[model samples]
Target: MATEDLMRKALEALGEVNGPMSIEVIHRLVDAGDVEDPMSIAEVSDLLDVSAHTLRYYEKIGLVTVDRDSSGHRVYGPESVRRLVFLTRMRISGMAIRDLQHYVELVDAGEGTVPE
Candidate 1:
């Protein structure tokens, strides 16, 4: 599916929910369709409306970790795509890269950090 379509679906899902939006909620919404097949960098870039260079920069800075295919092409799984969705949204909301990095660190630290 196209990134725009997925994003549209996520937004529609978001509209059905109440209360504050959390990472878990967003994840569920984005993962509702759950693309099982891995996607290429260009595909992801088009989906997130960001350039390939931006995606590379995000990976370079440790914001996300994408796997590599046999031919050495970047392969983005559902988790990575979901992370990109959150990251891109946060970025659009004015969260700094350092703050986002810290946030990701906290998230990776454990589920206990959710309340932090």
Candidate 2:
């Protein structure tokens, strides 16, 4: 798929997710661009089909908070990206939110261990 077309699909995926977008959107966002750092909330949501509101809830309870952009939008750097991926996996595995928050705090603290 084309780059722009992919981005649109990503935006749709991470968006309200009111409905499903084409599978191409998932494909493109997953590998589009040379994003060295993690994606913004919008970007992650688009790529991962997550709701920013859910992400925000994670942040609210200290699940994640790498930083924010100049516009005060949640800015998830590369580390955040990796953590989100892990979080998503855990969620899929049926981990509870409280447990996820604790795991996130450990990551923010540079533990990078345990939860095994």
Candidate 3:
């Protein structure tokens, strides 16, 4: 899918939330299956409407994990792209960074947090 399209869907996914919603946005976007081949950092950055520095920051904070190519350039795979989209949507929804970190922590914890 095109970057713009991905971004649009990401924004759209936020509508399912009224307020203080859970992380269903991630599952919704991920299950949408917009996975394309792995994309470069610039490409994913442009798609997500974020800067490279911001992407690096996301990684630094463990909000996302981007794989590196042989040359060490960050390559965003499909899962990573989906995650970035979700994270972008969450940020746009005014979710606090710490809250997002907690959400990520919950997600990383897997099915146990589903009841949260």
Which is the leading candidate under lDDT? Answer: 1
lDDT of 1 by residue, 1-116 (tens): 97656755665576733434444444454553456678999988766667899999999999999999899999999889888888987875559999999999998899999889
Model 1 clash pairs? none
List where candidate 1 sits over 4 angstroms from the true fold.
Answer: 1-33
lDDT of 3 by residue, 21-101 (tens): 334443454443486899988887666656899889989999999999899999899899888888887786689889989
The CA lDDT at 97 in model 1 is 98
Q: Highest TM-score, which number? A: 3
1 or 3, which is superior by TM-score?
3
Candidate 2 lDDT, tens digit per residue, 1-116?
Answer: 98766656555666723444445534543454345765778888876567988778776777666687788777888766666666765674459988887666666667456654
Q: Per-model C-alpha lDDT, please?
A: 0.78, 0.66, 0.76
- Model 3 misplaced stretches (Cα beyond 4 Å): 1-33
Q: Is candidate 2 or candidate 3 better by TM-score?
A: 3
- Model 1: residue 35 alpha-carbon error in angstroms: 3.3
Give the runs in model 2 whose Cα sits over 4 Å from its true position.
1-35, 106-116
Compute each candidate's TM-score over C-alphas: 0.69, 0.59, 0.71
Clashing pairs in 2: 14-45, 14-46, 38-77, 38-78
Please rank every candidate by TM-score, starting with the best. 3, 1, 2
| C-alpha lDDT of residue 85 in model 2 | 64
Q: Report the C-alpha displacement of residue 62, candidate 1, in angstroms.
A: 0.8
Model 3, CA-based lDDT: 0.76
